[model samples]
Target: MALSDIACRNAHKSDKAKDGKAFKLFDDKGLFLLVKPTESGWGKWWRFKYRFDGKEKQLSLGTYPEVSLGQAREKRDEARKLVAAMIDPGENRKAVKEARADSFANSFEVIAREWGSKKVQTWDEKNNRSKRMLERNIFPWLGAKPIADILPKDILASLRRIEERGTIETAHRTLQICGQVFRYAVATGRVDRDITQDLKGALPPAKGEHFAAITEPKEAAELLRAIDSYQGSLPALCALKLAPLVFVRPGELRAMQWQDVNLETAEWRYLVTKTNVQHIVPLSRQALAILLELQPLTGHGRYVFPSERTPSGIRCMSENTLNAALKRLGYGKDKMTVHGFRAMARTILDEVLGVRPDFIEHQLAHAVRDPNGRAYNRTAHLPERHKMMQQWADYLDALKQGAQVIQFPRQA
Candidate 1:
């Protein structure tokens, strides 16, 4: 017989402590109200018992009073249809739980960390810089939001806030990193599209002033002399001197490892962190001499310019080490920057030394296209670059000795 709503509500606790049992009332279609004894009174729960795929299972429709008799029978009838179709309602419940778990694992913070772990493999600033960029600029706004649900406007709004702080370059870089995160999410099937694409032309134009470089031969000669006179730590002084000769990025120069430099072969080979490519820097004789002189001091350690503040000397010098040294030498930010070394080398190598532009660009590790519009190999133009690098070093030495060098005429 089917149960009535009145009977479920009137069900009272029975003191069956001696038997250690409770009473159960049955309804049709395997629906029943379990009257279990509680400390205060009787507790009634609705349960449906059925068989699916030759095995019996039970589905809890919820408690009684909360889930009345009519509601419990409706659930039982719906579950019965699932059983008739060879499905288990219990399995459906488990599947729902698994889907929810998967969604949680795909949250923005979770996936961003996953992508960061892989990216930090090639990073040189020790991953702290990139991590901080995300934490400060990207995370607070969108970290908890679902990656798929983050539209272009949300990303644009986040970038606009960064731009308002006067760090326009940082704002651009933050947007780029966000795009990488979105692309990673897309590849992993977390999001359907990289909405950052819609944000083209969304940012203010960046200021076009190149890093302040001493492109004039006389001015560069003076700068080189000043670096030679810098009374700083041996590591700091050596890095300052080598910056102009190698013309690599400041971070790459500071993080140089002794293992990457082969003084005997006059070659320094290391992976370029910015481009994710292996670059070979042919050591000019002048540059090699500085490395040889400094090797005994830092060769025992991992870095060519190890941190002086550290007794262990295991870590590389900080990014600001060279800039601080320049400031100490009376060169302000407007006068010269650490990265200005690359521009200085590029200008003099072309205008003063008459080196081929392609050779110079390849040596500087700039992404350049061949006549066929293909990326020049990292090691492409080795023979020509090797010659150009030597000429550049010799020209600098001549200029340092007060030799008057004539600037080459630009070809039309």
Candidate 2:
């Protein structure tokens, strides 16, 4: 039967003899309230039903007098607005609740696993190192927490834990990796902001140190003589000889392929150079001779310096090979090393051979500023460089022959 506001308010709980039956009451309007007994011993609670999207939908507003007639009327009116807009209010409410729960439930460990699979496929060696560090250090601490809930304080605390081990460089690298992960989360709409953003200047600054190198030309000569005498593999010997002339990084030299070199043209083309640009190194006659000697052995392989352990394939030589060779010659921490060849060439070529510094810098693949405020290209000074490389090689031969050296005129 239809009910008045006073009747709805005056409704009382029925006894257990009623077997917890529910009573339905309707107002002067079509609005209805239901008072249903709980399975528990508690008294009855209330719910309301309304029409939405041309279909009847029930919305649980609240329990009885606890939700008075005025409040119930307000809720029913709001639900009518949603229904008029063709929305199922109950379903929307449930969706919103589920979304919130999911936001809180996703853990960092879940994200890390996804990151690892994606990284192995996409990232290079440097990025692979970052992934491993995160797996070993950061993941253990914060991997199980929702990425959204991880605050700046939490990241800082985690970094502090790494710093406690006196591995400041590692702490810095970990922070960088964490920042990348947070940025990834932001891109995917999983998190709003990267908390690692403000972490700049937060960690201890890395101490300045020079690269370990042999700078003196005399020391470099001694190292070279030692390498010539060393009884290592022919690939190692060829690398030692080429190291001084090319002055490329040890990594780049070790990774050189047979396709990059053209002995007939005396040109070594670095298609995949460190700067992500193609570089052409004009080979001197001496360099050509060195390669001709190595050709019979390594010419069949793809790599110029294939691993001795591998058959019919090229693997990168160990980074320590050249250094170990130098150590055997009694050169200690302060003396000449493999990488010092670059410094030795740059110094002697400029100071002793009197080649133009700009040409030297360009040949070294170092970035040089053009007069027109443009960037320098790898082949920018190729004509002068061709002659310069020949002269440089001849100058080294003269030094090896104990010729009395005279310094050349410097470039203006």
Tell me the lDDT of candidate 2: 0.73
Measured by TM-score, the strongest candidate is: 1
All candidates: CA RMSD (Å):
8.5, 13.4
Q: Write the per-residue lDDT of candidate 1 for residues 1-412, one digit (tens) a residue.
A: 7778877777663343335467778898888888877787667888898987788778889997888788898999998898888778889879989977776688777788888887754333443566678889888988887788788899888898889998888887888888888899989898898888898889987775467777888888888888889999898998988888899988788789888888887889998878988899998999998998898898899889988777576678887788889999988778899999898888877877777787888888989998899998877978767777788888888888889988776432
* Alpha carbon deviation, residue 45, candidate 2 (Å): 45
lDDT of 2 by residue, 1-412 (tens): 5555676655544342256566666663346666555666444344557666577667777876788778777887776787768777788789989986786456666665566556433233332456668877877888878998888888888888888998888888789778768777777777888889888888898674334676555655566667678787888888878888888777677777788898888889885344666777889999888888988888898778776677665465656776676677786546766767778889888887788999988888887897898888777889888888888888777666666667788865
Q: Whole-model lDDT, candidate 1?
A: 0.83
State the weakest 10-residue window (summed lDDT) of model 2. 119-128
Indicate the TM-score of model 1: 0.72
lDDT of 1 at 161: 88
Model 1, residue 89: displacement in angstroms?
Answer: 17
Every candidate's lDDT: 0.83, 0.73
